[model samples]
Target: MPNPSSTSSPYPLPEEIRNLLADVETFVADTLRGENLSKKAKEKRESLIKKIKDVKSIYLQDFQDKGDTEDGEEYDDPFAGPPDTVSLASERYDKDDEAHSEGNQFPPIAAQDLPFVLKAGYLEKRRKDHSFLGFEWQKRWCALSKTVFYYYGSDKDKQQKGEFSIDGYNVRMNNTLRKDGKKDCCFEISAPDKRIYQFTAASPKDAEEWVQQLNFVLQDMGSDVIPEDDDERGELYDDVDHPLPTSSPPASSQPIDDEIYEELPEEEEDNVPAQVEEQRKMNQD
Candidate 1:
């Protein structure tokens, strides 16, 4: 049986694809915000994300179908650096912090505290620093603990390469599946300062469970941190109230029922009187 927690996106979204989707979203939002574009005109034009759903769908399916058998069950990246030591000296992300590359300054919780790990798996992540010429997706081991989430190069070394305080963070799933995702398993994380990061899961079901755990942590902590939207979700996908359109199911080919439109026949006056006389005689009897 397939692992219940495994998601459809064994591979992460490519850099080019992520950038394209982000650009389309930016264009549509900018157009809507500008005084130049009328409501009628916006409605008339094709939706930005809807136009590319098919492309993303095809790419995602094709990628998954490729015959490659590397069991992800064994994800052990050799942990580099010294003994685990996390410092929460700064509330905001410190770009200069040599210990944390992602700039999140949350102090690392004891590994033992993560007794109830919501998820543990291998996923390819877009590098914090990327190159255009090369499709730069870095591989890392990801896990969600009770209070925090951690990603690093290895399970043995236990060096927390990157970490996120799940509580109070705004998480959003993609509107459509891409070559690396299914049922919108892709998602992006936004920090309070508006920095965004994207990740893809192995399948749609896995994504839902993951998001639920993230929200649960926030509630458990009673955190008041309000996530800032990045000039409108610039990390390829997230929550937009008038949300990006998702890929809907195909319409059925069956014809409409004719009985619904058919009219009832009128009652004849002669038959109606006879029926009334019979009813009166029966009542008298």
Candidate 2:
């Protein structure tokens, strides 16, 4: 017979058949427990026992067949497939090759004749040691294609303006000024010291190096590059007014009036000493 808890049957027994089977099972149980029967009469109970066993066997076979059908269906399904593999080494190599190729594509710029012009306005804005001068060198290279311009000025007025432009192997000072005094017409390369550095060819590729060297010199002098405009100067000063917050509350928001001391009553002051004396007496007792 199939276990009652087993889920092997695809269908249920008819109500009439179920009732008949239940009655047979009850009769078999009763027969086994009855003590009034003689030994010979108990042996004749085999026919009734066989009928109960047959009913259970039929139900059990049906349940087993249903279970087998379900298992077969699961195996026949075709959606399942194998997992995939990935190549970590190939991916890493591709990334490395890309980085190496990018590095080789660009050439370096030379220190001499850095091709660009530094705007006096821009240099003043940076106001940090070497940064202003470095920007000046970078600007010079950016402005003049492949030609480099050299500047001459005192440490105080690095933006005071005089520079010379060097293109290819040729070197010349730019000293032309506008008649209206509005702008400088020429670039300055050399100073009154007459110290002449050898003229060299520079490409856009060499801009970073030239700027670095110029910045180094400015840092050694211990001066910052300040902005040339009044508005830019004001911006630095404005920052001082708005400092970062701390744990203390803002002074303006505090309740100053609440902390002011009020006059005390004479009666209350007189009673204070009497109360203290009474408390001392109680403690002594």
lDDT score for residue 89 of model 2:
16
lDDT of 2 by residue, 100-152 (tens): 33222223333233344332212211111111111111111122222333322
The TM-scores of all predictions, comma-separated, are: 0.38, 0.17
What is residue 195's positional error in candidate 1, in angstroms? 2.3
lDDT of 1 by residue, 202-269 (tens): 67676667666676666657747654456655654545435768876554422233333332223354
lDDT of 1 at 62: 33
Poorest lDDT segment (10 consecutive residues) of candidate 2? 81-90
RMSD of 2: 41.4
